[model samples]
Target: GAGVSQTPSNKVTEKGKYVELRCDPISGHTALYWYRQSLGQGPEFLIYFQGTGAADDSGLPNDRFFAVRPEGSVSTLKIQRTERGDSAVYLCASSSFGTGRVRNEQFFGPGTRLTVL
Candidate 1:
């Protein structure tokens, strides 16, 4: 039973570069979510996927942010033209289902810390 995992626990980049963060969810989980947490703030939802389709992507801040979950397993968050304001910790979580009622607890992966300069 592999737990969720994220790559490049830390990242630092120039203000206009592109970056991609990866997440691997636990086996058998059907729902995956991406969120961003600024300093001293709670995680804000960015996108979610159920199976191979995005269920909710309303939280994505702008065109520079995008994510995909293909094969219903691993997912990647891509950011283009990164800005200084985009610096934050990107977190990924997964559960059996997206609904809170069906999946009470979300297993969180150690987040990727992104720093834009």
Candidate 2:
């Protein structure tokens, strides 16, 4: 894909259900990030992966939310025991993120809208 691509553009489920959101970053991008955006608000950082390891995950709300980038190119955000409060748009982004204080421009995906009822 020319840009970041996320699967299941929309997802709806009941509370307590588990959901997995997938993201494929642009080729050669070494950094991946996950975020959640609620109605009328900006995206909330969820996690950041440098290469195949999670460099930062403090943004996750709790243990119920997790993400992995096993291969360094694709990532999956798993939400367990979902709650109505979890309803939001999940966004994924990627960048070269080379060694430096300078942050590279991130390319974002369309996002997966998760609606919990």
Candidate 3:
């Protein structure tokens, strides 16, 4: 894909249900990030992956939320026992941290809007 892509642009689920949001980063990017945005707020960092392993996961609210990037190209955000407060837009971004690259240049997906009813 030319840019980051996310699946099922919208998701509606009942409280306590499990939902998985998927992200496909641009090819060859070595870093990926997951963020959540609530109404009128900026995107909140959730997780950051460097290749196949997560480098930073401290931002995840609790054990109920998790993310994985097994092969390093694609990622998934899984929410267990979803709550009404979990209703927000989940965003995925990708960037390269190659040699001599001091900063990350992120390309973002359209995001998956999760509605916990």
Candidate 4:
């Protein structure tokens, strides 16, 4: 089975630009999550989707960040008006279900490194 994957393992951008990061989850996984990790910090949850609906997006910093999961599969994280502070590693993970009751393990992608100048 194919595991989750993310593109452009690395990215460098100027401040105030826009960027889009893509994530492909496991074929049979129904729960997908996006998180950001800053230098020397833990990964912070950004958003999560179950099927085609976003189950939680409260972690998104602001209007500058957005994401979408269509057809209950692949997802994309879009950032607008990027700032130097936005530089970080964006990680994607997936599991069989959203609820943790089943002891599901989250498979993590390599992650996309975004650097905003």
User: Which candidate has the top score in lDDT?
Assistant: 3
Compute each candidate's TM-score over C-alphas.
0.94, 0.95, 0.97, 0.94
C-alpha lDDT of all candidate models, in order = 0.93, 0.93, 0.95, 0.93
Task: Kindly list the per-residue Cα lDDT of model 1 for residues 32-112, writing each as its tens digit.
Answer: 999999999999999989898999999999999999988999999999999999999999999885456454588999999
Q: Which stretches of candidate 3 lie over 4 Å from their true place?
A: none
Q: Could you tell me the lDDT of residue 80 within candidate 2? A: 100
Q: Residue-wise lDDT of candidate 3 within 1-117, one digit each (tens)?
A: 899999989999999999999999999999999999999999999999999999999889999999999998899999999999999999999998786267667889999999999
Error of 3 at 19 (Å): 0.4
Q: Write the residue-wise lDDT of candidate 2 on 19-91 in tens digits.
A: 9999999998888999999999999999999999999999999999989888888999999999999999999
Candidate 4 global Cα RMSD = 1.7
What residue pairs are clashing in model 2? none
TM-score winner between candidates 2 and 3: 3
* TM-score of model number 2: 0.95
Shift in Å, residue 94, candidate 3: 0.3
TM-score of 4: 0.94
